[model samples]
Target: MKLVLNTFFSFFLVSTLFGQQYRVLPIESYFKDISFFTDSSFTPIFPVSDNQVNYYNTTKEQKLRYATVGHYIYQREIIQVIKKEGAIWASPILDIQSGVERGDTAMSQYLNVRGLRIEGSMKNKVFFSGSFYENQAVLPYYAQQYVTNRGEFYPNSSDSSYHQVNAVIPGSARTKPFKTNGFDYAYATGMVQWQVLKSLSVSAGNNPIFVGSGYRSMLYSDNSLPTMNFRVNYTLGKKWNFQLIRLQGLNLLRVPYASNGEALYERKALSIGSIYFQATEHLRIGLIEGGTWTRGDSIQKQAVEGGFYIPIPGAATIQEGINGKSYAYLGLDLNWRVWKVLLYGQYGRNPYSKSSDVGQIGIRYWPFKSPNYLVHVEYNHTSSNAYKSSNPRINYSNFNLPIGHPMGAGVDEVIIRLRAEWNHLFVSSSTNYYLNQSDNYRQLLPVYEAASGTNQQVLYETFELGYNFNHGYGLEIFGSAKLRMVKNPLQNEQSYWFNLGIRTALNNHYFDF
Candidate 1:
């Protein structure tokens, strides 16, 4: 371990020979609007929400959402009960209020939501932040099925016995019961970071993250579940940045899970190390290695080692051969900017395994050089077993949610998006089409189900128009429509929603797949 750490830091030493300052932000995708901003920033891998919190808290001023519309956001933050106690501070406030009515349901066919955010810094060295939400919804037919089974935990147990429910498609996801008419769940994320050195930082938390500049990532993606994870970032001047990430995830099962009377969650560890470069003003490239290891019957933890083989991105395979079973994947990213437009592409695969891989290519156009006004399109495809393992316990998932693409595997997606903004007024739309292999989610056995060649398909589209109100704490008034068409149905499934709400953050969770 000492040798590994030393070697890793040596790269930073060589990189910083010219000396460069490092910056970190707590929010996973905090530094945004790249199309309109000049500085180049590294994008953290998805679902690891607390990256660089210490760096950001110490070096950069918190970006206030009050874009000065009506100035109400500042007042709401008056809920801040503490300020400046020897470098300690706080901002605790309730966020959004929203209600949505969809499809042919009557007065109660709606969704209701409330949220909270708590943030602060301490001792000038540590920073922490958390967000919470309580939501209840009368989802469309497919959505209800997706969430319930997507998280299907059969028969909650008060202990020995279980409270079971009927299931469709063999089983369902883990779904918590809600009000008489809908389903409800609580989502929470909290993370803390500490600055250990001028050039290095550590962050640990549970949340979702998005990697890459495209609509999706070939390696890790936001269309997954929040994970309990830790991340380390080191900068070597202006030319190189390195990141090491580790995750402890579970492969959920349909039973009232118990391991020797303990809540039995499968154990899987992921180690990803990446090096990024700014070759020139317009060219950037990244090389990354990722390893997935499953803790079979024994849940003992594993060590993180040897994942940074640059010329060979499959270093994880070395340990996998010694161990019982594991998966290793590698990625290459090319990001090039031409004046105002950015073109990017990525490819990732596990050479140690078969029938599991992903490839993506996409571009973003900033017409008029405005971040708020933009067009994006991307194509992505995943082989059937991309994130899966022979051991169902090691499949890349938590709460039955994938840690990569929302569609799981054996899927291809074409996504297009358009957004136009004028200060407080905004209009955005996205359409995604999917060609899915039938066994995408169900083939969890030691071997993946063979592809049938023939596939199922789905197309989903959404349009929204909203205006920021006072830019206050992300408060806005919006109306939106969504439609999904499945291959068999032939007819489209439509839903509509409108609300007055505050969204202090983007929707990082991938529930729309």
Candidate 2:
């Protein structure tokens, strides 16, 4: 303990003597993919969205066509919205994509996306950002099953034999019934950031975030909607960094439509803290701690967490009473760089409180001689009920989405991703296999029971080919094949999906799950 503390102080003192400044790129992929980043690990060690994105790399403008009109237009970033240098400035963010696809079944496969964003900074001190997104689609059968099972957008009353309604999306109202079994969803996100000191910064926003650089997250994830929150970051140059986040979340359990007054989605307080160290030029380590607590009922309006108000480790367990209602999560990960290759792994457990464990191991290799080619392989597993809870309102979920792992609990998966880039074009492919175990414990119950069934096996694969016609903008063709096999009852199914489109700008690509 003493040695660790001394190391931290030594690093801090050295960093203070020559404090360097760095900002986290926007959580969006475009900013990340086009910015100055550390290979596949991405910008600033993957924390939260509180860091300001002060840099935008325009060097990759080779694929652009007529993007610059000899000095009047530069990548269309400032179509003259406000292009003054060193003064207040702003620009429009636009993305439009429409495509036609088909599956084996009769369901229509029409995919369309429309998005708009407005972002800018003033005097390099204050900054603002906002985005609006609208999407409509005819999803494949397996993806459709995942959405309908959320139990949100419908009342859940086990009072009768037939009291369940299949729903497509949470926080979503049916969109006038599309051609076939299609659905629609809309989202709005915004944030403001202020740089107070070279070593300190703060931001308040309602935007989704993925906390880890890996393909999946075991801590914080963007699968859920933007939770209104505040974030603060402290850093001592590019060597050491720290972050704290507090979010306002919602519970998805629903009440009957016949009730006199509907219950507001139950409120939840999610607090997270993390510290990362660039231990050496080739090695880095990160420590994360978090808590999820419910509000209302007998509990007061204040935070009743076991861990410190600041960042500290704790077991995110659910006890029978107060101990049972609250949850805490803690974990650590390491990244090792050997020349051009990167190796990483993580281990997390909620033992005493929640009888579950989680782990991940992965390697990313990008040949130093040829940095444009890459290969990544990873394995992830979550014990039964790892993200589940005895309290419906306090489980590791927001609305209908799991905040930790996308598969929730009781699943083992292997992921392999390969990518190659050549000037204006890129090709990539990924495959995933998940072995899932059905939960043995009943919902909202404090006890457990023995499982009476077998596990299910699922396989998912995807391929993509994209070409950039304009600086940072392009056309993409993508497809996926999913297969699920079950036992006991005996079942097997296969489905395929595809999409092709031209986009001036694009948002996060979340279908990777």
Best by TM-score: 2
Question: Residue 5 of candidate 2: its Cα lDDT?
Answer: 59
For every model in order, what is the number of clashing pairs? 15, 4
lDDT of 1 by residue, 232-252 (tens): 877788778778777665555
Q: Candidate 2 lDDT, tens digit per residue, 33-68?
A: 333124433223332222232233333332323212
Off by over 4 Å in 1: 1-69, 74-109, 122-125, 152-174, 254-262, 298-315, 435-454, 470-473, 489-502
Candidate-wise lDDT, in order? 0.56, 0.55
Q: Residue 55 error for model 1, in Å?
A: 14
Candidate 2 stretches greater than 4 Å from native: 1-24, 28-55, 62-104, 151-180, 237-239, 254-263, 297-308, 311-322, 353-355, 368-372, 435-454, 470-489, 504-506
User: What is candidate 2's CA lDDT for residue 325?
Assistant: 53
Which ten-residue region of model 2 has the weakest summed lDDT? 440-449
What lDDT is obtained when candidate 1 is compared to the true structure? Answer: 0.56
